[model samples]
Target: MIKRLCFWLRADRLGPDIPITHLMLYFPALMRMICSKRFNGFGEGSEFRPGAYADNCSSITIGKNVAVRPGTMLFAEKGDGVPGRIIIEDDVLLGPGIHFYCPNHSYKDASRPIPEQGYFYKGDIVVRRGAWIGAKSVILSGVEIGEHAVVGAGSIVTKSVEPFTVVAGNPARLIKRLR
Candidate 1:
């Protein structure tokens, strides 16, 4: 019900502060919004499935036929400064618990303590067209998953995955190239 209200609020069809109970009372309309791929957010023909978690700070630009599965979290840096943009090209499929982080904590300065460094470094995260990220995958900042690549489940992607390749495990070593 909260999701539906959020969608409606984004679409500007309904104002905020509309009681959740009332939205739930109109269950049919709520179902229509949830089931339909066209509502809220900036993505053409992209589907963020129910239970998918996206942060408000995140700026998501998606192309056609993109599917972000349930339990996936997309986080972007916040504040007055511009964070990073998350660009998911067409026909991308993201599985459950896939986390795309756009910001990294600064650890370069020897003089500054970790917590005292305070500044967040950001870099754009791009998942090119037709990439499939499997469940429990973690994609860090400044990395691009090339077109048609497949990331195996539980992989931690800290670097770029070449086009048409399949990668797995921590640090995501390339397992094979897809023909």
Candidate 2:
């Protein structure tokens, strides 16, 4: 009953296709409450800044003290009736314009257009505890960003990053390994 009411209120206030859903970024308590009700698992003190977009909130799990900056997009691909999961562990810091894609499209058939080929589920994306993903970084499917790892700004993470390491550049090469 309350869930339906909240949904109706949101739909009425924000309309159907607003780019930014939650408007109260400055109000942490309200934001936390709203996100906790929507997401799969939203831990305490986790905040989603204004303009953060989640394609399917039910597939995204946010941990405690995680800060997702504005313009971050969390997209969980739905395949075989199961949506891809994005698990962001505790104390992670996500910069603006960060993108996490849990599934990729199949383009094996050259004859068909890329869009026509359709998509496939790669796997869940896990950002381990204390990891920091920099601004505009793109994290591809089936990648596990290890604990305390730092992904540099504008990097494209194609593979699993090692724990306590710093990665940068296109394809995200390991720049340094922290203690």
Where's the lowest-lDDT run of ten residues in candidate 1? 12-21
Q: Report clash pairs, candidate 1.
A: none
Residue 17 in candidate 2, Cα distance off native in Å: 3.7
What is residue 5's positional error in candidate 1, in angstroms? 9.1
* Shift of residue 13 alpha carbon in model 2, Å: 15
Task: Kindly report which residue pairs in candidate 2 clash with one another.
Answer: none
List TM-score per model, in order.
Answer: 0.72, 0.86
Clashes of 1: 0
Q: After superposition, how far is residue 6 of candidate 2 from its true place, in Å?
A: 8.2
Query: Candidate 1, residues 40-117: lDDT per residue as tens digits?
Result: 344555555555655432366667877666667776543234556677888898888899887766677899887666
Stretches of candidate 1 off by over 4 Å are 1-45, 78-81, 109-113, 119-122
Cα RMSD, model 2: 3.8
In candidate 2 the C-alpha lDDT for residue 152 amounts to 99
Clashes of each: 0, 0
Error of 2 at 102 (Å): 1.0
